[model samples]
Target: MNGVSKVSPGVGTGLSKPVAAALSIVDCDFHPFVPLQEVIARMPARARRSVQVSSYAAVLGREHNRFLIPTGEPLRLDAVPTRGGLAGSDPAFAVADYLDRWGIAAAVMMPIQAMGVIAWAAEEVVNSYLAAMNDLFLEMWHAEDPRFKMLISVSPHDPDAAVREIERLADKPGVVGFQIPMGEIGLGSSAMFKVYAAAAHFGLPLVLHPNSVDCSLQNSPSCAGRVTRSYAEHHVLLSQPGQGAATQLVMSGALERFPTMRVVLAEFGFSWVGPMMWRMDTAWQRGGGADGLLPRPPSEYLLNQLRFTTQPYDEPGNPRDLVPILDSMQAHRTLVFSSDYPHWDTDRPDVVLRRLPVELRERVAKQTAMETFGTRLGL
Candidate 1:
């Protein structure tokens, strides 16, 4: 709040130019950051001292994005106002820059720090800091506009705490989903079932935004033992964890246990869904679909339970080629639009997949998102 000035209409006047040709849109993976300072400010005194006087929550400020060329944090520099402030640190600017400019009907808040906090903090520290950030999100952004729905971030480190967080804020008009931090943990592991159950109980989806965290799960962030050299390689392989998580969740019996559970693979490209689903379906059938577990093939569980964001939608040499890819994933049923706004590589809704058939395009641009998050517009 100290450095983030409210946008003066004339200065930061007018909303951003619309990306896609559409007027009404629902952006699923928007990042709303509470400055690290603000998060520290909200912490209980001991935590506050821990953050300021010592190296507490240091990972939040780490250079996790620079495994490639020295390009800094993924945020767009322009997003940091000419007036001086951290990029994405101001909600008023986001209104002027993303929502108002594009005539966006609704945008989900996936706070970056909210996810990062869980990756490194101790369970107790994670709980207090997360709760504070949730409250901060309500006061700073969600309370400002109903269209900016909040996704409360929960650490898998504490299942009971995660459930409590869900129950505590589920009834809020702006709270719509939960950010399930990407870690060594898989979606189906018994450790995560409680979090999943709690989310299903509230009808809120769990968002798994991939991170370069400590996970021995799949092909490590790098094929060998190192971080890849460029963002291009890392970006291309971003869907691995989503694929792995889906496999684990299905095999672990989490989906069969909580049938209504919904999962959103945030920023995880949609292109992989077709191949992954096919692979799982084939495996499930060969393995008898269930050794006393899953009643349906893995693909059925994935198709019905999971949704993917089209931020880095497949871009073949010809954009039209991406259509077949979307079709394979059942575009209308499984895809949702996510700009990943304010990031340096943020997608422009109008430009990303401007070549799809008119009807199919609209579903990706808005309708699917409406179905995914629509229940909250009135509340």
Candidate 2:
């Protein structure tokens, strides 16, 4: 327990049994929701007024087209809380439905409401929303259950403000990491180096949640530099931002600059990572665009400090073909299991664990997460 911190009982009698008694799996990408009104209540009067007049839809996006069919929320119909709200809005229900059932020892709660708003919203508005979100998650969600560790949300629009936010809540119980939506700004931008440096200093890993804005707005360019016409197109191209993030972090020397800071690209698939790394290394050797920026090979930095989640795990035409791709990507060492619980296309732990080759299951389920999150997981 030297570098690691354990979660102690909070107020009520905790879960009926120890969280570790189950599978010892760590879910790296679990979503927890706060109602729009709840978030508005926490915002400053001016910010609240802005959100109230504009409404959640208008404030978040005016023209963004989302195509969630049937249920309409990209959420599992069965995940609706017993208390009657959105699927992830109830902490106790999430625990019962996803965590306890799957034997997840720890679940990292990624905030959902204010995500991807940084690029479009004003600085003060985004700052107020994110700060309020961090407080709300800490008080309403994590405080209710020690098993719910959160990656506090912070807008990347203001690095000074972001650093201050980090300092304010760095020591709060149940805060395990930082979640930054990769807005129009690339992760390697020097503006983010302060946030990166602070994360390194705090020993908190940073998780980059892909920004949906890229697929919706013309100004916010998608990986292909054009607006996606449909949700299916958006879903198919989700890994582009993750790939861009990994490439920028390596080639721009961000990873080399903040060697201690670990980054996880959540909800983005990993089958393409091996090929991306190979391409980066080849470019590094041939003196590609990275030029004087990188001191070591790009792949080395990625393998050392970067991690990717295994949700929407790739399904090839031939089921047996997965093992080779998994081996090529060093899945046992670099991949972490993320159920993406309550989301429509969630992967069940039992199913994912079963799908993984026997030798790699333990690491994908738990060990790699422990390694990635380090002391934050209290493992």
Candidate 3:
């Protein structure tokens, strides 16, 4: 599956032939980036050395911030071919290779390193690094193929800078949206509101992703005695952003203020959304909420405004039971399929789709993503 193949042109394993043929599947989440040394080489002089030092320290397990340490052996720059080296990592595996292999038409490439830069760097440093990284991505990846597009990275730590960057890149050929973390700087804060306004103004979806926020858990109670908590953090981090950010968006009336704004809670599994929505709704009814605290049911706000990605999905004993849980929680259209490509927990599309029931599989695999990205099939 190294290159394109022409299959029968329908969703192969799920749904009736007619319905499958009608669906135009687009993988809404993908990632693409150069090797770390190459990225460091491109950074400004002021930050380049520090960034490189951090990278080395990370690989050696010498960095104080556990989040900064590499989870595996660092990629040797010498091992990556100088002329063409796109196939080794997860982004290439998902966006480029998987599309050709799985019969997907296109994939929106999100940022991985940008999330780290935003999470750890100072506001000014993060903004500058983000601009450079976005340009690097546009030139290196997005411009290479129309089938691959991008979600521009933004540092919400500096709302004004983020707004300017959004305006600057909004109309660029392959840029589709903005990327921000799920729980950074408090989702309800005024700074984030500005970022949301900019996205709404440009008709771009805000992709709320997970990064170091989960990495912080290494020092928490659950992992205190353990030498490493990366795996646990990775799984649990998915729900935290959705839980905390959704509460902020509803309670602070950010959704009320920006009716047209859309949010994609990336990497976070959809299983928790139903329960969170129910809990918020129940609390609202009991006068322990944000509406009278602000003016609507938190779930209503979510139903109208939010979309979530399904990856690292729940394995509640019986795999067949997942779809019904999603439906019971009213999370059908709200769920979009994501591979979390290149990471340890990457789910195979074929496997995940096979696990889902027919109708539910169709919605998660294709329909919901099309509706969320506002792109038509065969476009």
Clashes of 1: 3
lDDT of each: 0.71, 0.77, 0.64
- Candidate 2, overall lDDT? 0.77
* Tens digit per residue, CA lDDT, model 1, 189-275: 788888888888888877777653422122234333356557676676677767777778777778889888777888868888887
Q: Residues 1-379, candidate 2: write the lDDT tens digits.
A: 6869756433122324433335678999888887666777888898777653322342254334433334455787777786687778888888776777668889998765656464455788878888887888888888878888888777767888889899889888888889876765678889889998888888889987654544533245555746666667777888887888888888889999999889988977898899999999888888745458888888889998989998978877776788888888888888998988878888877777778899988898899889888877877
Error of 1 at 170 (Å): 1.2
lDDT of 2 at 367: 93
Mark the regions of model 2 whose C-alpha exceeds 4 Å error after superposition. 1-21, 52-59, 63-71, 216-221, 288-290
Least lDDT summed over 10 consecutive residues: which range in candidate 1?
214-223
| Candidate structures ordered by TM-score, highest first | 2, 1, 3
TM-score winner among the candidates? Answer: 2
Model 1, residue 163: displacement in angstroms? 0.9
TM-scores for candidates 1 onward, in order: 0.87, 0.89, 0.80
Q: Say which candidate scores most in lDDT.
A: 2
Which candidate model has the greater lDDT, 1 or 3? 1
lDDT of 3 at 279: 88
